[model samples]
Structures are given as C-alpha cells and as structure tokens.
Target: MVSDFRRKKLLHMYKFLDKDGSGTIDKKDFQLAAESMTKQRGWKEGDALYKESLDMTDLVWNALQKAGDANNDGEVSADEWVTMWDTISKSAADREWLSQYCKFIFKMQDFNNDGFIDSDDYVAARSIAGTSKEDAVAAFQKLAQGKSKISLTDFQKLWDEYFLSEDPNAPGNFIAGKSSFD
Candidate 1:
C-alpha cells in the first residue's frame, strides 16, 4: 500500500513526467523532456551531446514503459505509475531502474559537469522543468543540507528516499521543489 506521503510524491513525479500536461506519460513526454533539456543546454540537433541525450531519454522511456505500463497500453496513467512505484518500493532488487534514473538526472542537474550539484545547477535544472526559481532555491537548500553542493552519492540516497520514504519530514521530500511537499 502506498502511504499518503509517498502517494503525494509519486503524483508529483507523474505530473513532471506528463510533459504535455496530458495527464499520462508516453514516449512523447520523454522526447519533450529531452528536447527541453537539449534546448536549455544549447545543444542543437546533430550535436553529439544532443544525440546522446536523446538516446538516454529513449532508454528511460523504454524502461518506464516496460515497468510501469502494466496494461501494455504504451502509456502509463497515474494509477499505474503509483502501483509500479509501490511494487518497486517493496523490492530492493527492482530499484535498479530507479537508481539508474537518479544517476541520469543527477548528471543532467549537474549542468556544469563539475561533479556536484550546487544551487545554481539545481535552480537551472528545475527551471527547465518549469519550477520557479524561488522554489528551486528552497529545494536546493533543503536537499543540500547546508552544504555548498550535493555529490552524486548523496543525490542517490536522497532520490531513493524521495520515492520510498514515508517520512514527511525527510529532506528528500523537497527534491522536487516546494509543490511536492505542499
């Protein structure tokens, strides 16, 4: 069973994934996310980085469809997404996909490629996702825990907690910005 706290977090995640605001997640959302990221990074078509980004997004989309599209409908609804997370949360072994995605997002958020996610990186990355700068800053402060930056290892732990932790006060609760916790 998904707790209220976890359900809220999962819903927030679903909203983020539904890039077209279509109330469901499909391959198009992943493509939109990739395009947005590449545009934010100024990586034009034919650029190696742009191609690599698209490939990565494709991998994520394929994995998501396989794991979350329970009805084989090629799209995942909020209920399916929640059920998938609930199942994944119960099995440590099933969390590999989540871990991989967390790493991928960490890399994306580390816009400077400096091996760390500072306030600037967090704000910029969240902004691309349509989060307000103030909310992003607040989230960064909470996730960073007074540190100047967040390392990949720390980010992985936080990402895991964000999805699996039922504790409302967990810092990971803030990872998606204020709206997640609110």
Candidate 2:
C-alpha cells in the first residue's frame, strides 16, 4: 500500500499532468503539453518532429488508460489515480513498473535520442510542463553535476526519489517544475 505521503506526491504529480485543468486526466491534456512543446519550438504543420511528440504523448495517454482508467471511461479521476498508485503491481516480474514508466518518459525527453538528457533536452521538456527556461536550466545544471549529459541510471534514480522519497532537497523534486508540495 502507498503511504499517505506517497499518495500526496502522486496527487501533486497528477496536478502537473492535468495540463488542461479539466479536473480529470485525459488524452487531450497530454496533447496540450505536446502541442505546447511543438508550438514553443515553432514546428510547422506536417513536420515529423512534432508528430513524434504527438505520438509519444498518445502513448503516454494509452499507458495511463491501460493502468489507471478503472472505469474504462477514457479519463482518470483523482480517486482512480490514487487507486492505481496504491494498487501498482508488486510482483517480481512487474515490480519495475514505476521505474520503467519514468525511464520511458526520460527516453522521450532525451530529445536527440542519444541515451542521455542534456541541458537543452531537459529545458525543452520542462518548458512543455510550464516551467521557465531559466529555472529549468539552473535545475538541470545543479542536477547535471558538471556533466553535459544525464544517463538513464541517473534519470531513473531521480524519478525514484521523486515518487518515493520524502527528501525536500532531492533534484527529482526540482525536475517536476513548481510543485506546490515543495
């Protein structure tokens, strides 16, 4: 069972993911974030770049639906989101669901698909989530540890801390933008 603190953290994350303020998480919210990225980057229509973003966002919606949409009604309510986290599969074969989901997103945020997330990629992804580029850059630089890249292990570790750790100074918290819980 997820602790109350962990459940609160998940709720914090849900607020961030509910980009459209629709009181429910759905595909359109994901699309809004994807669209924000493409628009901020000035990607023109029919461009393959934004299309990749769109497809990736769709994949996220699909994954969330598969895991958390208990009613099969296409959107995830706050209660359902909490239930999903509380009931996350704990089997040895599936114990890595949270990590895998983080890695999946980290992979997408890698931008250049170079197996690492550099400052540019980090800022780009953060911007889509409504963070200021300056704040994102500072956070990335602090987390990057003077390296120009962030490896998958490092990325996953941050995410682990983000979802499971209560450390106030964790870089994982910074990566999630302006979390009110912080």
Candidate 3:
C-alpha cells in the first residue's frame, strides 16, 4: 500500500502532469509538457534547448509508459500511478537513470549553457510548469539560498527532495514550480 503522504504527492503530481486534462497521463501529456517548456523559454525550431526538451519528453514518456501502463493501455490512470509509484519507491533508486534525467532537466532549464540556472532560466522553466515569473522568482530566491546560480547538482538535489523529502519547507519543495502541492 502507498503511504498516505506519498500517495497524496503522487496524486498532486499526476494532476499537474495530466496535460490533456484527460484524468490520465499519456505520451501526449509529456510531449505537451516539453513543448510548453521550450515555447515558454522561446526556444526556436533549430534551438538545442528545443531539441533537448523533445528528447527529455521522450525519455520520460518511455520510462513512465512502460512502468505505469496497465492492461497494455498507453495511458496511466490514477490506479496505475499508484502501482507504479509504489513499485518505484520500493525499488532502489537507479542513480544512473536519475543522473541522466536530471542532466536533461537541468540542461533544458540552463538557457545559456552556462552550467548553472539563473533567475531568468529558472523562471522560464517554471513558467512552462504553470508558475508565473513572479512566483518562480520568489521560489527561486529561497531555493537559491543566496546564490546567484544553481548548479546541476543543486537541481538534482532539489529533484530528489521533491520526490523523497517530507519536510514542508524544503528548498526543493518547489521543484515542480508550484508553491501549493495541492
């Protein structure tokens, strides 16, 4: 059984990730998410960020679809999400896979290939995830912890906190760019 807290988080995540509002997460949802991030960041057709976003989208879709698809269906329903979440939580976290995905996420948000994410880049990425620039700025201020830039390691740590930490005030809590986890 999924823990109450984890279950809640998963549902909250699913709600945001269900890009089509279809009550399920599918390939189109991931694709749209990538497209939105790229578009929000003004990544043009030939831009590397645009291509990277698309690649990241495919990776996420491939991983989740394989694990979360039940009954051979392409969509991941609430029940399936629960099952998949529990499974992932039980298994040891794969550092290699996590590292790759984290790299992709940080790269897409880097904007300038500067090896760090600044306020502008952070806001751009969050905007695609449903946050306003103002909100993202506020969150990033706290998340940055007096730093002007966020390294890939910082972003990855935040990513882990978002998934694994129970602390309400965790700096990484806003990894999804949402102040409200509801």
Candidate 4:
C-alpha cells in the first residue's frame, strides 16, 4: 500500500545515508557519516578520517542496525533501509499516537495544565526528556510551528505519530526489540 512518491523518497534517502556503498553498514559506516557530517558543518578541520569515540560509534551503529535491518540479516538491504527511514519521515504526519504523546507532553509541559507551555513549562519538559536547553527550545519551536502555544489537536497528532509507531500492536511496529530498551 506504499505510495510511489513516498517509496521514491525513502529510496533516495537510503542512498544518501549509505555513504560507504558497502551494501551493508557497520560501525565504521556510522563513524564515517558522523565525521563527514561534522566536517560538513565546519565543526572540525582537514579531510582526514576523523574517528569518533568508540562508545559514540557503537551507539550509532547499534541504532542504525536495529532500525534499518528488517530481515534480521545483520545488514540492511536497500529496501529495508528505505522502509525504515520512510517510516520515521512519515511518523510526523501520523495522528493517533501523536495525540496521546502530545497530551502527555502537554500535561507534563503545562505543569498545572494551564493550557500553555511557558518558558518554565518548557524547561521542565526539556529536563525530563534529557535534552539541553537549546535543543529543547528548538524542538518546541519546530513542534509548535511558530505558534505561541500548542493545541491539544496538534499535540495529539505529533504524539500519536511519535509513540504509536513504537507500539507493539502497531502494524509496522513489529521491529524485533534487539535490546531491552528497544
């Protein structure tokens, strides 16, 4: 039931993510990608193959493997990579779980449920989400869409999409939880 447009987009993104062209990504792939991204952003100098800390590389490798390897093959087929990214991209528009997650975020953000997420409200949620102040503010700004406040409907839409996709009962949420946190 996947549409042509969405399918094409996913395929495109997969190519962009597969920097190594090895037909399969490993920890080295993520490290290279991260280093490239950092250098592209002008965070470092020179064209040398910058190395990420072992711990950081391990985390990225594990995340990509879990999210993109759909066939339990320990590697990502192009189709699997495309599907995984497409699902994440599509989640923004999903309405069910987004609504619930938004409510939770709002209630958590609003502190007293005063129908608004003020600076203080945002601070609390940021702390809870373990995001830095700048990141938290940026995330809110993006989610709020330049609005001064987020409506329940908006929150719900975002929440449902973000959370329901991970729900065990969700149709495409059948990802094998390889890790306990998964």
Candidate number of the best TM-score: 1
> Candidate 1: lDDT of 91?
83
TM-score of 2: 0.73
RMSD of each: 1.4, 3.4, 2.5, 13.2
CA deviation > 4 Å runs, candidate 3? 1-3, 42-49, 93-96
**Predicted candidate 2 versus true structure: per-residue lDDT over 1-182, tens digit per residue:** 76566667778889888998989999989888787777876776699877877877787678778888999999999989887766653433323556656776786678888999999999988887668998888888767767889899988877766665656667766567544363
Output the better candidate (1/2) by lDDT: 1
Please write out the lDDT profile of model 1 over residues 1-182, one tens digit for every residue.
99887898889889888999999999999999999889989999999889988988998888889988999989999999999888888887666667778888898899999999999999998988778999999999999999999999999989988888888878888788764544
Cα-based lDDT for every prediction: 0.88, 0.76, 0.79, 0.51
lDDT of 4 by residue, 1-182 (tens): 34454444345435544678876656666567566545543445443323333334455557667766887777777777656656755664433332342354355456546887655566555554345676556556655666777666666554443323333333121111111121
**lDDT for position 28 in model 4:** 60
- For all predicted structures, in order, the TM-scores are 0.94, 0.73, 0.82, 0.39
Best candidate according to lDDT: 1
In model 1, the number of clashes is 0
Superposed Cα deviation of residue 179, candidate 4 (Å):
36
RMSD of 1: 1.4
Instruction: Name model 1 segments beyond 4 Å from true.
Output: 179-182
Give per-residue CA lDDT, model 3, range 1-182, as digits (tens). Answer: 76566567668888888988999999999888887877777888899768877987888788777777877788899989878767665675534455677788788778778999999988877776778888999988988889999998898888777666666778877776666654
For model 4, give the 10-residue run with minimal summed lDDT.
173-182
Ranked candidates, highest TM-score first: 1, 3, 2, 4
